[model samples]
Target: MQIQLNTDNNITGSPELLSRIQKVIDHELRHHAASITRVEAHINDTNSAKKGEQDKRCMLEARIAGMKPLSVEHRADTVSLAVSGAASQLARLVDTTLGKANGSEKGGVSIRHLSQNEQEE
Candidate 1:
């Protein structure tokens, strides 16, 4: 899978930072490597460097094969926290979405809807 990193004016996109983010994504999406095509991450400061505000924003988008891209976003005081939160959410989303695409039952329960005629009978 491929990964792209983007940073707004407030945050700097360093090589180390990119490596760290990519590592987190790879670790979280280990099982879905085959189905996931690419992931793009964006980090920005929502408050524009205002002092006491929790404005760090992280956005993640995962492209799944034959499926629309799934996205998640998180905000925190630190870029790391926001990125971590978004990464976890994106991983869960991929699992749920791909699981559904594979026809896997959800929550270990299956429900069937009966027709009106069958119910009457």
Candidate 2:
């Protein structure tokens, strides 16, 4: 899957951060990589230097073939935490989406017809 990262000014949005986020997403969702076309992650600081905690927000959108886009959001005290939390959510979302699209429920058996020779055995 191709991962695209975005962040507001309040967040550092460094290349290292983006790389780390991408790696997390890739590792978490590796099984669904083929079906997924792209992933867009938006990170921001809701409080923007405010004194209160849990201000960072992370929104992730994953696009899969023959299915509606799947999204997940998480809030944390820092951008890294938000990213990690969101990535985990996105992983589960992709897993369920792929399962449904494959006409299976969480890796359930897919019944199929067998050829005449094979069926005889």
Candidate 3:
């Protein structure tokens, strides 16, 4: 999947930072890479130069082929932590979305199979 990184004026989009963010996102979404077309990451310091807790904000948007895009965001004390949290959240959302699209049974029941069960009952 292609990854695009964006940062606000308060933050610098350095090569090292971009590489690290890419690796984190790649590792988290490896399972759904084939379905994902691109991922855009937006990072910023909410407090700018001021010191504050959980000021680093990271937002990740994943575009999947033939499906609506999904987005998730996280805030933490550090940029890495924020990105990690957002990636994890996005991974879970993608897994749930793909599972539903494939009609995978979730919680031991599938909505598509519910009608059959009702008729039998």
Clashes (backbone N, CA, C under 3 Å), per candidate, total: 0, 0, 0
* Candidate 2 C-alpha lDDT tens digits along 51-106: 56889999999998777889999998877788889989998888777777677878
* All candidates: TM-score: 0.84, 0.84, 0.87
Score candidate 2 by TM-score against the native.
0.84
Best by TM-score: 3
Task: Flag regions of model 2 displaced more than 4 Å.
Answer: 110-121
RMSD of 2: 4.1
lDDT of 1 by residue, 1-121 (tens): 9999999988899999999999989998998899889999999999886865569999999988778889999998898889899999998888788767767645232335767787677
Candidate 3 is scored at a TM of 0.87
Candidate 2 accuracy as lDDT: 0.86
Model 3 lDDT, full chain set: 0.94
- Candidate 1 residues lying further than 4 Å off, grouped into runs, are 107-121
* Steric clash pairs (candidate 2): none
